[model samples]
Target: MIRPDGFDAVVVGSGPNGLVAAVTMAEAGRRVLLVEAADRFGGGLRTEELTLPGFRHDVCATVLALAVASPAFRALRLDQPVAGHGPPPVEWAHAPIAAAHPLDKQPAVLVHRDLERTAGELGQDSAAWRATVGAAARAGDPLVDTLLAPLSLPRAPLGAARFGALAALPATVLGRTLFRTERGRAVLAGMAAHSMLDLRSPITSGYGLMLAALAHHVGWPVAVGGSQSVADALVARLVANGGEVVGGWAVRDLQELPPARLVLLDLTPRQVLAVAGDRLPPRYRRRLSRFRYGPGVFKLDWALSGPVPWSDPSVSRAGTVHLGGTLDEIALSEAEVAAGRHPARPYVLLTQPTVADPTRAPASRHVLWAYCHVPNGSGRDMTEAIEAQIERFAPGFRDLVLARHALGPADLEARNANLVGGDIGGGEASLSQFARRPRYSPHPWATPVPGLYICSASTPPGGGAHGMGGWQAARLALRRDRQA
Candidate 1:
């Protein structure tokens, strides 16, 4: 229970990271209070009837591959149900095919849960795929643990070394060098584009390689009933652990927060500067001011009358689809966005949750979501361009839309301030930011301020549903308290 004086720890935001931090502290027998400015607990883990009634859409993150593999969530037992068995707090619903990439002329390349099956499809490059991505998968959870927390010592040094050797190269270089087949390279391009970085950028290969390995390790699944269920489950875990959560409480400054021995901020550098700039030392604040955010996104959600009628009927069986012709096309699109110019044919990412969990839509109806990268803080509407791209692959796609909702970078930031100009991966995923997120430090989470820490997506392991930042912060907080 919280003491009459104050809670033992107070978390300022309720993103996946914040929720994890609160849960960590509360379960450790500390009095924890989690506060959010939004009406609900989840930050990016939000779901709403974005397009129309009865058509629930994930506002941001939908895939649970990282959550399923996260050590933090695993420690919290998020994958399991409470003893009695009504249902698991967050039921994972997976599509038969994890992901697909369609070509202008050829068949769509598919990433199946079975590594061998996916490998076999690559034909000539099958051995290459098995050697690189498959090697990481064989290393299993330990390698993933090290990747997610790169600063930590690897339990599998050989695995990390081997993975890092390939991981260090640009996706363009790795894909072309490693895979001889166009099909193999195209699939790698599709996965690498998730980085939102130029395919030529260093460590972009690492992003793509990690995701491919995860598809084999844990099939990209969605939280049934919407991604909100994941947030609800985390909140329930916190409450059960005697932690308190208060929504619609915005903290504009450090003085606004309640008395607590520790304060963990689940926010980016921009929000931190707004709320606690005065409290931080000049050098730390200066570093945060110089932090860079990568490309923003133009998001579109649709309530469809039926499934997207892809030219490749098999594409409907996959939960996620990448709609860019080939590696060169995708690379060019990303390069355009990076150069502050929107591509006429942007590399589009589409997700159909109803494929795996029909509960997202009404009856036989469906909902489709697609987004394309753009310059940070862009205001241009890409609705026509995006729909045209979808129609290019999925003929009659326009006829399927019952309603549509679009959000530019600004709109996204307005809705959830953490998204800041719609850079969803949380501040650039560049190699430099990965190591010196906010600022270089032995423990970045622990700010110079006493009893204060930052555990946002801006920290190491950069972006994803994994709560490693919070897990690390909470561990540090606990250790410090013991010493004091």
Candidate 2:
């Protein structure tokens, strides 16, 4: 039976952003309803025994670097202890090193939490490495706050300006101009590849700088049990603050929902159009249609008999590994995907969660999570290419796999409807797309229909598991509610 009493606000979808929005609104004394299509609450925060029963794997996002640094998450106090949960709010465990970028002939470049240690390992380019990443790290939370929030006049304008000037250059230009050694260049290239754009594209340097700085600011850590623990923490906080979540309720249309003063959508533009296209103005609909998506990702989960035997033993010390020989190789691979082709030796991002969090796997066993860029919606399987790349770095990597599960573009989209064509970063992170997102407007979150707003990763600070988009939209909704 449908309840006649409508909520003060209804948040569609229960991703990190949606959960944050619901929590924010509920905390403000509003009766909120958080809805999800899946049986689970977390969107990308799911964990499953995909390959084997004993080994647990993160289905999507594994790292919590961005989550910890996000203003929205910080405001919610997710790092603190919750009443019901055994661990503190999102218990995190870090490896000795944050990330390792391995090359063919030289020692792998390791990114340690300590900036000086990371720089010292770069050999000839140590000074240049420190000047760029170390300098950004020194700027610290103020710099992070400026980058994570919506595009606006920053509180620390000088720091923002300095960071912006350097961040605007192409990753290729930054690598070639600033560093001479493959060690430093590979590290920066690995970071930039996270943007899923061509390394030559403008503002690609920003991705590299931001990720590198994050490594120093907060080491890339995983939730104690799995990524789901992060979501569980958020849910615990939300429930404590009076928000309620209804799982397995797939909202097909906005009109079908119970009456509410505000509706926050955690969906991307495509899904939003399907649900509320008729109500939206023609101009807004067109803008949403124009919202471009980037390259897709081909992911893999492996139940390993043992740890990946890296040629460089130090590579095992890090939680995440970037496997592609050098800067030029990674650039070529990324460029191939952007041009709608798959590289034979694709650049791969692999995370061995068990290294830091032992609870993820049974004793003497390990779990490996990895993915590589593929052309959007491409049906071709790149498991062979990906495994081959890992094998290149860790000679007998394939031998350690007791079982493996692969998700191509279609599989990824099927699991999470928001991952349109498997383009994971909400939408393309291009300079034009970054500024305009769905469209160029002062209030990007607001729609033509009153009381409706978009709070997906497609908004400002696009992509990653950060909850800023939902937080920004909810804050806006609250302001409008006060005005009403």
Candidate 3:
């Protein structure tokens, strides 16, 4: 039984963005309703015991670097501890090291919270590392603020210009030109590979630099319990602010729901077309149909008997680990995936939550979350390849796995509709796509359908757990409502 009235604004999804949009509208004194297709509220933020009881695993996103730095999240005070949640605070647990990239013949390259410390570990490329990642790190939150929003004249012009100059180059070119040692290049390359773009692509360095800067700005933190705790906190705040959330309710048609003054859809382009295709103009529909999606991911979760036995001891301290070896190796692996081929040694991004927050698993046991890039809509099982890559850096890793759960591209899509073809970044984060996501309207969130808007990761500041897209869209809706 669906409510037929008394809502000023309606949000179509309940992901971080959707939750943010609903909360924003509710805080603005608007009667808001948040609808979710899934049984759970969080889209990427959901956590589950995929392997065994008590061993919690983040279903999609694990790290909270971007979320911690998000202006929208900060404004909502989500990082603070709520009165009822717990005493330890449902905020975040910063790992000792942000991330560690392990190699076969040398010590692991660790991204420390201290910029100088990280650069000092780079050997011959220390000066260059200081100039690039170190400088961005010093820029801090201002740099993150600029990158996390739509492209505009930055408030910190000097820092933005410095970041832009380096960000303009391809990761491969920048890595080769600046770093003399493989360790330095590998460290940066591992960060860049998160883009899901080829290393040779222009502006790939931007992703690398942004991620590294975030590592220093706010160490990659995880929720106190699991990612679900973050969602629970957001939902609690939303409800506290007078918003309503309805789960297990999919909106196939926009008109099916109660009439509202504004509708903010936390959905991708393809989904928009499905729900409101008849309401949109022919030209707008055409633009959405042509929207591009990037490579997919093959995700795996494990309930381990013991910790991953890494050859490098530092690897155990870090929350996140990049398993691909050298700069060239990661570049080759990313290139292969983009070209629709799974590499024999794929780059694996692994997160050990139990290392930082022990609540995720039982005593002396561990939970491992890892994923590797694959072609869009790929059904191939890369379990063997992924395990082999992990074993390359961490010996006896397989022996520790008590149970494992794997999700291919299709499985990811089945679990969450927003992850089209398993692309967790909403859509492709290519330079061209960044400029015109879905379509090139001046107000990207506002659809041509009068009161409808798209506020998912498909909008500006493309992906991540950051709720900027929803926050921006909610602001737009409020502005439009005032005018109306």
**TM-score, each model?**
0.98, 0.98, 0.98
lDDT for model 2 = 0.89
Error of 1 at 401 (Å): 0.6
Q: What is the C-alpha lDDT profile of model 3 across 1-484, one tens digit per residue?
A: 4457758999999888998999899989988889999998999999999999999999988888888889888888876665653333466887799899999888999998888898888889889988988888888777778877755557678888889899988999999998899998898899999999999998899999889888887789999789898888888877777778889988898877787889999999999999997899998999999999999999999999998999998899999999899999999999998899989999999999988888899999999989999999998999999999988888899989899999998998898899999999999989899889877866888899888999999999888999999999999899989998
Residue 185, model 1: Cα distance from true site in angstroms: 0.8
What do the candidate models score in CA lDDT, each in turn? Answer: 0.90, 0.89, 0.89
Worst 10 residues of 3 by lDDT: 81-90
lDDT of 2 by residue, 1-484 (tens): 4447998999999888898899899889998888899998889989888998988999999988998888888788877877764446678899888999988877788999999998887889999988888888888878888898857557567877877888999999999999998778888999999999999999999999999999998779898889898888878877777777788898899988888999999999999999997999998999999999999999999999998999999999899999887899999999999999999999999998999998999998999989999999999998999999998889988888999999998998998899988988899999999999778987788888999999999898789888988998999999998999
Backbone clash numbers for all candidates listed: 0, 0, 0
**Deviation in Å, model 2, residue 459 alpha carbon:** 0.6
Evaluated against the true structure, the overall lDDT of model 3 is 0.89
Candidate 2, residue 41: the lDDT equals 82
Cα displacement (angstroms), candidate 2, residue 10, comes to 0.3
lDDT of 1 at 29: 99
